[model samples]
Structures are given as C-alpha cells and as structure tokens.
Target chain A: MRIVLHIWRQKNGRSSGKMVRYELPDINSHMSFLEMLDVLNERLIEKGEDPVAFDHDCREGICGMCGFVINGTAHGPVRGTTVCQLHMRHFQDGEELYLEPWRAKAFPVIKDLMVDRGAFDRIIAAGGYVSVSTGSAPDGNAIPIPKDNAELSMDAAACIACGACVAACPNASAALFTAAKISHLALLPQGEPERHQRSLRMVAQANTEGFGACSNVGECEAVCPKKITLENIARMFRDYIGASWTRRPAGASRG
Target chain B: MASTFQRTLRFYEATIGKKALIAVTGAILVLYVVGHMIGNLQIYLGREALNAYAHKLHDLGPLLWLVRGFLLLAVVVHIVASIQLWLMNRAARPSRYVRQSWVKATFASRTMIVTGPILAAFIVYHVLHLTVGRFHPGFNHELDVYHNVVAGFRNVPTSVAYIVAMALLGYHVSHGAWSMFQSAGLHHPRYMPIVQKAAVALAIALFVGNISIPISILAGFIR
Candidate 1:
C-alpha cells in the first residue's frame, strides 16, 4: 500500500518547524504505526537524509512512550490505542496522514514529533506519591477497602502519563493528567493522610507549569489511551475545592 | 494571622478558584435570566398587567437596588474571571495546529468566548433600549413597559438585533449552564444527562420566550 505523510520537522527546541512531505510506496498493513515509521527512517538513512525523531520504548501501548497527532487526532484515529499499538491496517491505501508533536507550552518540542514531557514528571514529583512506612509486604486484604472505591482508584491509576490528554485538549490543559493522578490517590485509604495536600500541591505545580485551565471541553477523555473519564476531573475539583476552603497548609499559605 | 479576606484572596489566585467564581456568578446570572424571561412573558396580558408588573418591581425601591447591585457584582466577577482564563488559555498554546478537527467539542462549547462578549455588548444595548429608554425614540417617561416593548420591536432593525442576540444567548447558555456544574464539581455520571438536557431546555425556553415578544409585536399580535 502507498501512503503520503506530512510530518512536522524541527531540528531542536529553538528552531522553527514546518511540515515536510514524504511518500511511502511499499508499506505493509500488518505493521504497527511505529514500525512503519521505522521503515521510513531506514529508507531515509539509506538515502543519506536525517531520520525523523520520535520517542518510543517497549513498543507495547502500556509504556505511554510513543504518540503524535495523526491527521489531527492524537495517538492516531483508533480510540483507546496508543500510536505504538496502532496498526497500519486501520488506514486505507493511498491515504494521506499528517503527523505533529504535542503542541503545548508545557510540552516543548525536542525534535521532529518528539516533545519534552518533563513537565509531567515535575507535576508527578510535586505530590503524586504517598507516604508509607517502609516494611515487608503486607497482606493484600490487610486494608479494608470498598470494592467500588478500589475499582475506581484502579481506573484512575490506569493513566500512563503519555501527555496525549494535554495534546488533545483545545486549551492545552493538563487537567485530565493532573486529575487522574490526584483521583488515584484520593480514593485509596493508604493515600488518606496527605490527600488534601496532594491535590493542593499537584494543582499548584500544574498551574506554575503554564498549562491552560480546563474548560471541560473533554477532548482529552476522547483521545486518552486508558479511557480515563471526566469523572476523575470532577473528583480533582472536589478535592481541590475542599482542600482550598478547609485546610490552611503551610506551603499553600506561602503563596 | 491571615484575615478571612486574605484567605479568600489566596483562594482566588488558583485557576480552579477562579473557575469556581465563574461558576457561582454564572449560576446567579442564569437564575436572573430565567426569572427575567418569565417576568417578561407577561406582556401577553396586555398594557395594564405588564405596566403594573414593571411598577411593582420599581416599587421594591431599595430591595430592587440591592438586587441590581448584587447582579452587577456577579457580572463583573464573571467577566473578569472569564477574561483572565481566556488569556491564560490562549497563552498555553502559542502555536496552533496546522490542521485541526473537532471530535467531541460542540460548536456551542468551542465558541463561548465569541458568544460571551457579544452577549455582554447586547446586555448593555438592551438595557439602553428598554430599561433606560435612552436608545428608544418612542420613549415613554411613565412606567409603560408594554408601550416601550411594542414600540421598540416595531423597528425592523431593532427587532432583528433582538432576534439575533437571543439566538446567541441561547448558544451561550446551552454550553455555560452544563459547564457551571462541571466547574463546581457538582456533576455525577447518573445526573449529567439530566443536567445537559436541562441546560439545552433552559436555553431554548429563554430563546423562545424572549424572542416571542418581539415576534408577536412585529406580527401585530401584541399591539
């Protein structure tokens, strides 16, 4: 099958970018999207041209390492599938696709289709951790948790931190990503001690990172590989509001 | 010790806090518009009833001023929060996509800013034309709201503007009503569909109720 690609090319963060077109005449429908890109890169290297740059590891979708906008939708057109797991079979012959990096002030471009998602790391570092006593593994049923709460917590924990939510949001808001992290902890009993502070600090960190506030457009939920719901966002809001009005944390007071 | 006012200031500093303010003020405004539309629908009762309703409102005296004052505050805060967030949202994305397509976002959801400012402007003009009688050439100095409304809608351009503004208001409220619940963390999966449908229904009711006056007057049914 033949495919036409219009991919954004940027040498570095400070450099300007533009769409560069290439045609792949020999492409297999069975290959994953990233594998097809590898074939294109091989041809580019054979022709003595600079190969396209993108981040990927563990070609499985679980890594959350590979993604880029394809024809306007993040992680390609397949719902709940990462670009690394998105097979070429989804596309028709003689199709034209546009690929671009995640465009957000928080996620700067490192190279062609490669963005620095260090902002996500910084947000996680802010308060995505729970404090626990270091000891041997406890019994699984030691902590009495409601079944519904456990399931909901696991749902929120399914977030892979891929930055697709940020990429897909019209305002470039990281609300979904931040909300997922906050909701994951807010639900479990182990995450109780610092629940309020977690919401406060993590949200503050996200704000300082210059992400847009969520207007609840919900583009993020639609493109999320984990199928995280907007319910997580609502939970984040509940936590944040409760924290802001009730608790006078020392760190937040400094602001 | 930080004062309560200081704590409130600190709360308003975050984006969520600002959004909360927007939601609260938006709720006040939404309630006011709904009540205002219901009151206006009394024009079908003829001149004396509508004029008496206007007189009774004016007779509220200080209470009327108090309500007006609170509404003014709501409007100011709502616009300020919206503008600040709008600027931040724009700054968050310095460069837009070369080719973008909408997936789940509705036209009403995407064009809030556009519809918002126009609605604000329409509010000012609407007040001048109807309330203050400043823009009305057939101004009646007395509390003859029925005459004022009929005379106002008699002008072709004025009626057209009112129709257009009502349509935009419907679009704005359809997105905003549902959005307020989300912003306030008041949404639940079970009740969300009801909230969404209610928003649309309110928008439609406001549009039809408000615009029906102009249409009735222009069609010689209200005269």
Candidate 2:
C-alpha cells in the first residue's frame, strides 16, 4: 500500500525545519509504525539521504522514550499505544500520514521529532525519593505496609514518564508523572518521614520547570500508556497542602 | 526561553496541555481579580485614596513583577492549553452549534474556554488603550487612565462588548470555580451541588462587579 508521508526534517537543533515528503509504494500491513519508519530510513540511506531521526528504545512500549504526534494526536488515534507499538494495519492504504514532534514551549524540538524532557527528571529529583540509608537492599517483607496501601503504591508506581500524560493533558502538566512518584512514596512506610516535604517540593518544582499545572483533565490517564490515574494527583495535592501546614522550620542541613 | 537542543536533552521540559493551562491560568486570574477588587474598594475613598493605594502597590516592584509574571505565564499557558484542547476535542468529535431542544447546562460551562482568552485579550487591550496609552487612536496622557477607561466605556459598542463578554465571564467563572475544587479532587457527593451553587453565586458577584465599570460609565454614573 502506497502512503504519502509528511515528515519533519531538520539539520540540527539550530537549523530551521520543514516537512519533507516521501512516498512508499509497498507497506506491510503487519509492520509497526517504527518499522515502517525504519523501511523508509533504509530507503533514504540507500538513496544517500539523512535517515529520519526520532526517539525510540525498548520498542515494546514499556519505555516512554519513543513517541511523536501522529496525525495530531500523540501516539496516534488509538488510545494508550506507543508509536513503536502502532501498526500500519490500523491505517488505510494511501492515507496521508502527517507526523510532527510534540509542540510546547516547555518541550523544544531536539532534531526532527525528539523533544527535551529533562524537566520531568528535574521535577522527579526535587522530591521523588525516599531518603533511605545507603547500605543494602531491604527485604521485601520487612516493612509492614498495609495491604491496601501497598497495592495503591504499586498502582502509582506504574508511571513510565513517557510524557504521554503531558501530551494528553490540556495543560501539559506533569501531574501524572509527579503524582506517580509522590503517590508511590506517599503510600509507603519509609516515605512517611518526608511525605509532606516531598509533595510541596515536587509541586513547586513542577511549576518551576514550566509544566502546566494539573487541572484534573483526566486526559492524562485516558491516553497514558501505563494508565496512571489522576487520583494520584489528588493524593499529591493533599500531601502538598498537608505538608505545607504540618512542616516546621528546619534546624540544620542534612548531615 | 532556552535553545531547542537544551529542551530536548534537558528531559524535564514539558508543557501542560493548553486546556489545563487555560484552566489553571484562569484559576490564578480569578485570584488576581479577587485581590484586585479588594484593593479597588479603596476607590470609594475617592481618587486621592485610590491613587495612593495604587502607588503603594506599584512600589512592591520586583515582587509585583514576579507575581504578575507568574500570572502572565499562567495566562499564556491557559490560552495555549485552551486552543490545544479545543482543537483536539474538535478533531476527536467534531461539534457543531445548532438551535435545538436539548438538556440544558449552564451557559458558563459551555463557553468558558471560548470566552476566557477573549476576555483576557480584552483586558490586555483595555490596559493598553487606557493605562499604557499606546492602543488608543486618541491618546492623551493628560487624560488619566481612569478617564480613558470612563470615556472608553461610554461608547455604545464598547459597553455592549463588555456586557456580552462579562456574561460569558460569569458563565465561565461559575463553572470554573467549582472545577478548580474538583481538579483539586474535592468529591463529596452531597457537597458537589452546593459547591457548584456557591461558585455560580460568586461568578454572578464577580461578573456584576466587573461589568459595573463599563455599565456605570455608559450610564454617566462614573464621571
């Protein structure tokens, strides 16, 4: 099946970019979107052109690295599938496939389709950790976490940081990302010591990093590859307000 | 703004969806409006008092800039988010407006996103046309911003625009106030309707207060 391709091309980050058209006469219905791109790139390379650059790793959709907006919707029209997992069979023959990188001031295009997502990392670093003693891994059963809480923790722990939630969000908020991290720890035993501080710090960091504030749009979870819920955001909000009120001035820096 | 390379590699750089940005920015603007109103009440003290109060607020300088900048950022984010969501929503299921019998919802709820940025854009022009003295075809700095505002509203078309926009503003804010709480995850079933009603009342109050400036000016009451 021949499909018309409108793919973004740029020399580098500083260079002006434009959509370059390509025509593939024979496309496998069974080929994943990435695989189709691969075939195109192979053709481009053989013909002495730069291969289309995009972000992808662990093409199985578990890793959040690979995704570009397909025909406008992030990861395409099918809900909750990564670009790598999207198959050509879902599309019809000769459909004009318009592809572009995620568009946001906070997310600048790196090359053709890749975006800088370090803001997510900074948000996580601000308070996504439980300050555990760096010695040995704790035995799984040692912490007497409540069964319900333990389950909830795993649920929040499901965030893959793909920025799908951001893509899906009307605000591009990392609410789901931050919520997953905050909730993962918020539901745990070791996390209690710094739960409030974590929420306040994470929320502040999230704002400072330029992610849109969470408005509980629920689109994040709806299109989330991991299906992270907006409820985690609620939990984080509770922790933030709770932490702000309960927290006392620090006596000294961490030893 | 950082370079494109910096954005890609930085990893954390992410935008909130345009709709959510609009919602949150609208949330912040509501706050600013509330604060503005409380301060504007100093107007009843007469021009000397109001000007003095305004001068004092201006003296806050960088702090004021910081707050204003954040608010502006929120507004930008909100507008962008609204457009993105509206586009996506339109694409997901194209909606068309038609006059027909249907189950009715609040006017504010339906048009909040549509009317919101228009109001914000008007506010920008309002400030510019009156305060900055740049947007007006007839600029006279000798005519104070207050005077420009007064005369501007006296125009029939301008006054009508304010009234229509203010009605939409009321509708948007009414739904918005309740939504912010919901976004924060306040879900007690029994309290939802009550909360929504309170939001509606607050919306009405805000709309009335804001519209008063234009309406009063047109009525020859604020001269």
Candidate 3:
C-alpha cells in the first residue's frame, strides 16, 4: 500500500518545526506503525537524508516510550493500543496521514517526533511511591488486602505515562496521569502512611509544572493506551481535598 | 496582613484550588437561581402574592443588600477564576491541532467558555432592565414589582432576548452542575449517572421556569 505522510520535522528543541511531506511506495499491512517508520528511515538513510527520530523501546507497548498524534487521534484511530503496537492494516490504501509530536508546554519537542517527557518523571518522583525500609520482601499473605481493593489498585496502576492524556486534553492537563499515580498508591494499605502527603505534593507539583486544571472533559481517558478510567481523577480530587483541610502544618497542632 | 495575602495567593495558585473555587461559587449561583425561580413562580398565584413577595424582600432592607453583595462577589470570583483558567489552558497548548476530536466531551462542556461570557453579559442587561430600570423604558421604578416584570416582558425584543439568554443559561448550568460534583470530589461510580441525570433535570427545569414568565406575559396569561 502507498501512503502519503506529512511529518513534523525539527532540528532541535529551539528550532521551529514544519510538516514535511514524504511518500512511501511500498508498505506492508502486517507491519506495526513503528516498523513502517523504521522502513521509511532505512530508505531515507540510503539516500543520505536525515531519518525521522522517534522514541521507542520494547515494541510490545508496555514501556510507554512510543507515541505521536496520527491524524488527530493519539496512538492512531485504534483504541487502547500504543503506536508501537498499531498495525498498518487498520488504515485504508492511498491514505494521507498527518504525524506530529505530543504538543504540550511541559513536554517540549526534542527532535522530529521525539519529546522530552521528563516532566512526567518529576511528577512521579514527587510522590508516586511507597516508603518502606530496606529488608526482605514482605509475605504476600501477611497484609491481607480485599479482592476488590487489590483489583482497583491494579486498575489505576495500569497507567504507562505515555503523555497521550496530556496531548489529547484541550487544556493540556496532567490530571489523569497524576490522579492515576495518586489513586494507585492511595488505594493500598502499604501506601496509607503517606497517602495524604502524596496527593497534596503530587498535585502541587503538577500545578507547579504549569499543567492546566482538569474540567472533567474525559479526553484523557479516551486517548489513554491502557484504557485508564477517569474515576481515578475523581479519586485524586477526593484525596487532595480531604488532605488539604485535614493535613496539618509542619509545626502546627497535632490533631 | 501580608501573611494573609500570601495565603490567599497560595490558595489560588494550585489548579485544584482554583477548581474548588469555581465549584463553590457555582453552587452559590445555582442555589440563588433555584430560589429566584421559586419566588417568581408566585406570579402564578396572581398579582398580590407576587408583588407581596417582592415587597417582603424589599422590607428586609439592609439584609437584601447583604445578599446581593454576596452574590455579586460570587459572580466576580467565578468569572475571574474561570477566565484565568481558560487563559492558562490556552498557554499550555501553544500549538493548535491541525485536526481534533472529542471522545467524551459534550456540546455543553465544550461550549462553556462561550456560553459563560454571554451569560455574564445577559446578567448585566437583565439587572439594568429589571432591577435598576435603566435599560427598559417600560420599567416601573415606583416599587411596582409585578408591573415591572409584566411590562418588561411585554416588549417583543426583550422577551426574545430573555428566552435566548435562558436557553444559554440552561446549557451553562447543565455542564456546570455535573462537572461541579467531580470538582468538589463528590464522584462515585454508582451515583454518577444519577447525579448527571439530576443536573440535566435541573437545567431543563430552570429553562422552562424562567422562559415561562416571558412567554406567559407575551401570551397575555400573566396580565
């Protein structure tokens, strides 16, 4: 199948980018989106032209390193699949595709389709963790968690931080990502000690990073490759509001 | 004073804080609208009941001013916070999408930015026309509340504007009420559908109740 591609190209973060057109005369329907791109790069390399630079690792789609907007939808027209796993068969022959990097203030474009998602790392580092002493692994049966709670925690934990939520959101809000992390930890007993502080710090960190506020648009949940629900955002709001009123000052009253 | 000022600044700095402010102010406005609707519905009870209700409100003297002052503050805060949030959102995405699609957003949710400012403008016109007797030539400033309402709605242009504004207000409130629950951290999966339905119901009720007044006058039913 032949496809016409309009891809955004840039030399660096400071450079202004534009959509450059390319035509692929031969594309296999079975090839993944990333594989198709790899074929394009190989042809570009043979002609002594600059190849498109996009981030990818573990093409199975678990690493969350691969993504770009394809024809306006994140991870392509297919739902609950990352770019790395998206197959070329889904698209029609002689299709014209538009490719662009995830556009957000926090995630600046590095080169071509690559973007700096270090803001996500900083947000996770803020509170997306459980504090435990260095020791042998705890016995699984010792802390008996309810079946429903365990499943709920796992559901929220499925977020891969692909930045699709931020890209798809009209406001470029990171509420879905931050809320998934907060809800995942806050749901478990092991994450109880610092749950309040976690919600408070993570949300504050997200705001500090210049992400927009969530207005319950639910676009994030729609574009998420992992199918993460918007309920996590609501949970995060519940936790943050609960913490803000009850969490004490550093040297204030104990109660 | 400086510390208090800093604390207030810090409160508005967080995105969640700004959302909470919008939700609270939205709730205040919703309550006022519902109360106003019920009071105005007394117009069905004939001229005496409706005018007597207005007279009772006016007789409260300074209390009436206090309530109006609080409502004015709520409106100002709601508008300012909403505008700041919108601007921040715009700055976050400097580059617009060549193509865009909405997954779960409704027309009401997407049009809030447009409907909000229009509603604000309508409020000014409404207050000037009915409350202050400044805009409408038929407005009675001699404490004839019933005469003022009936005469104001008797104008064709004014009635049309009122109907249109009420429709926009309904759309605004429908989205606002549903989203306010999420913003205020009251979301529950089991109850969310019910809450959304209630929001839609409230919006429709307000639209019907408010528009009915002008419609009734235009039809000679309220005379």
Candidate 4:
C-alpha cells in the first residue's frame, strides 16, 4: 500500500517547523509504524536526502521515549498505546497522515518529531524521589507497605515521563505527570516525611516549568500509554490545597 | 497560593490568566447562586421569615457594598475570561479534527456562553424589579418585598423574560457546575459521573424553583 506522510521537519530548536510531505509505496501492513519510518529513512538515505529525525529507543513501547501526534491525537489513532506500538494498517493505502511533534510550551521541538522533554526531568528533579544514601540498598519488606497500597503506588509510578499527558491536554497541563510521582511516593512509608511537602513543591514546579493548569478534560488519561488514572490528579490537588491552607504563623512567607 | 507574582500573572492577560479568572469567578457565581437559592427557600417559612432574612443581609451596612463590589469584580472577570477563551479557541483551531458531534448535546451545554449573559441580564432585571423597584412602573418600592415580586411578575414582558432567563441560567449552571469539579481535579472515574448528575440535578432544581415564583404570580396564586 502507498501512504502519503506529512511529517514535521525542523532544522533545530531555533528553526521554525513545518509539515513535509513524502510518499512511500509497497508498505507492509503487518510492519509496525516505526518500521515503516525506517523504510522511509532508508529510501531518503539512498536518495542523498537528510532522513527524518524522531525519538525512539526500545520500539517495544516500555521506553516511553517514542511519541508524536498523528492527526492531532497523541500516539496516533489508538488509545493507551505509544507511537512505536502503532501499526501502518491504521491508515489507508492512499491516505495522507499528518504527523507533528507533541505541542507544549515545555516540550520544545528539537528536530523533526523529536522534542526536548527535559522539563519533565527537571520537575522530577524538583521533588520526585525518596531520600536514600549512596550505596546501601534497603530491603523492600522493611517498609511494610500493604499489598494493595504497594500495587496502587506501582501503578502510578509506572509513568515514564512522556509528555503525552501535556500533549493531549487542551491546556497543555503536566498535572497528570506530576501527580503520578506525587501520589506514588506520598502513598508509601518511604515518602512519609516529605508527603505533604512533596505535593506542594512538585505542583509549584510544574507551574514554574510553564505547563498549563489542569482543565480536567480527561484527555491525559485517554492518551496515556500507561493508562494512569485522573484520580491521582485529584489526590495531588487535595494535598496541594491542604498544604496551602495549613495556616502558618504570620511572617512565615519568608521561611 | 503559588505566589503573589504568579497570581498576578494569572490575573493579567494570558491563556492562564483568562482560565484562572474564569474558574475563580465562575466558582464565586455558582456558590452565590446556590446560596441565594437556598436562602430564598425561606419564602416557604412565611413572609416575615423571608423578609427578616433579607433584612439581615441588608443589615451588613457598608459591608453590603463591599460584597456587591466583589460580585461586580466576579462578573467582569467571568465575562472577560469567557470572551478571551472563545476568541482564543476560534483562533487556535478553527475546525475540529474530529467531526463535530455536539448535536446530541443539550442547548444548555452548547450555549453556556450565550445563555450565561442572558441570565446575567435577567438577574439585573430581577434586582431592579424586586429590590430597587426602579424598572417596574407598577411596582411600589414602599410595599415590602413580596408585593413587589408579585406586581413585577404581573407584567407580560417581565414574566416571559423571567422564565427565559431562568431557563438559560439553568443551562449555564448545569454544565458549569460539573465542569468545575473537573477543573478542580475532583473528577475521578467513579465519582465524576455522580458529580455530573448532581450538577445537572441542582441546576434543574434551581430552574424549577425560581420559575415557580413568576408562574405563581402570573397564575394569580400570589397577588
């Protein structure tokens, strides 16, 4: 089948991006989307043209590095699946596919379909960890986390820091991504000391990083490859609001 | 509580500013409307009960003026924010990527923006007719609250406007209420649907309750 692709092309972060069109023929319907891109790149190289650049590491969908908006939906037409896991058969033989890098103020387009998602890393750096000293590994059973609680924590911790939530959101909110970390840690004993403080800090950082506030459109959950629930967003809000209303002594703003 | 500076940025002109303004103002309006409805329920407790309650509110002296000021600010913010949002949406994406399917949706949900201002106009007329007694020629300000409301509703135009405005207001409140829960991030999987239903039910209740006042007056039950 022949497919017309309108892929986003950018020389660099400083350059303006636009959709560049290309036609690929004889594509295998069984091949994964990334594989079709591979064939396109091979053809580009043979023709002495610069191949399209896109983010992908594992192609198996666990890496969380691969994602782009296809026809305005993040990670293509499928729900709860990454672009790497998307297949060519989702398109028609002569249909045109509009592909662009995930649009968010934080996720700046680096080149082609790749974006600089380092802002997600910085938000994590702000408060997304439990304090542990360098070398000695503690036993997991030491914390005595209940089975249900541990599983719930893991479910939230499954977020791979992909900006798909922000991409899918109407406001480009990173609340889903930030909430995932805040709830995952705040639920467990390991995160006890910083639970209240963590939600406040991460939420502030998310705003500082130029992400939009949550509009509760539920688009984030709809496109999340990990299928993270919007409930975590509520928990994060509850924590943030609770911390804000704690009523510290006067002149405490300086502290 | 992000920061004074951040809040200012969220207040001034920007995408965030407009949305924040809308949410803050909308929340205030909805809360007050619900409270107003609840307070008006005192009408069923007899005339003195309702009139005394109104007196207590008016007894706030200059503080009543302050409350009115805040409500005015809310109105300005809410209207400006909505206009900005509507314009931004128009500029950002002119056409839906998916086929537009708001057909099955109710007029109330689809027409919140239009109906909201109409409701606001109705509210202003309501205040003028019953509270100040300035707009209604037959209304006697010297007569206490109950007679003014009854006399105002006797006019055909006023009665029709009351019904139309309440209907639009109901539509705005229904969508706006549930949307607030989502905006505040209270929209969980299990709780979201319940919240939506409750918002709609509350809106309908207010619609029916408020409409009954004019209808009763028109039907000659409350002269």
The most accurate candidate by lDDT is 1
Give the winner by TM-score.
Answer: 1
Q: Model 3: runs farther than 4 Å from truth?
A: A251-255, B1-9
DockQ winner between candidates 1 and 2:
1
Write down the TM-score for model 3: 0.95
Every candidate's DockQ is 0.68, 0.06, 0.58, 0.21
Q: Give stretches of model 4 more than 4 Å off.
A: A247-255, B1-28, B35-140, B143-172, B175-190, B207-223
Writing each residue's lDDT as its tens digit, candidate 2 over A1-255 gives 888889877677677778888999999999999999999999999999889999999999888899876765678767768889999999989998878776554566688888788888888889889887898988878878898898889988877788866665555567788889999998988899888788877777876766665544456667677777656776766666555444555763431
lDDT of 3 by residue, B1-223 (tens): 2254665566677778788899999999999999999999999998899889988999999999999999999999999999999999988888877767776778898888899999999999888888899867777777788899998989999899999999999999998998898998888889998989999999999999999999999999989
Query: Candidate 4 on A61-177: residue-level lDDT in tens?
Result: 888999888877788778778888999888888888888787777777788889898888888888888886688887658768898888879999999877888777665778899
Q: Worst ten-residue run, lDDT, model 2 chain B?
A: B93-102
Q: Candidate 2: DockQ?
A: 0.06
Tens-digit lDDT track for model 4 on B30-98? 888888878876666666877788778888989999998999899988887777666544433222232
Regions more than 4 Å wrong, model 2: A135-140, A252-255, B1-114, B117-177, B183-223
lDDT of each: 0.92, 0.70, 0.90, 0.76
Give the share of true interchain contacts found in each model.
Answer: 0.71, 0.06, 0.68, 0.14
Model 1 per-residue lDDT at B60: 100
lDDT of 2 by residue, B1-223 (tens): 3454653333222222232334456778888877876675554456666667766767898998898789778777667656655553443222111111112224555566677777887778667766677645555575344555666777778778777877777777787887776654454546776987998898888787877777767777677
True contacts reproduced, candidate 2: 0.06
Off by over 4 Å in 1: A250-255
**Which residue window of length 10 is worst by lDDT in model 4 chain A?**
A241-250
Of candidates 3 and 2, the better by DockQ: 3
Q: Compared with the true structure, what per-residue lDDT tens digits does model 1 show for residues A142-237?
A: 999999999999999999999999998888999999999999889999999899989999999999999999998889999999999998998888
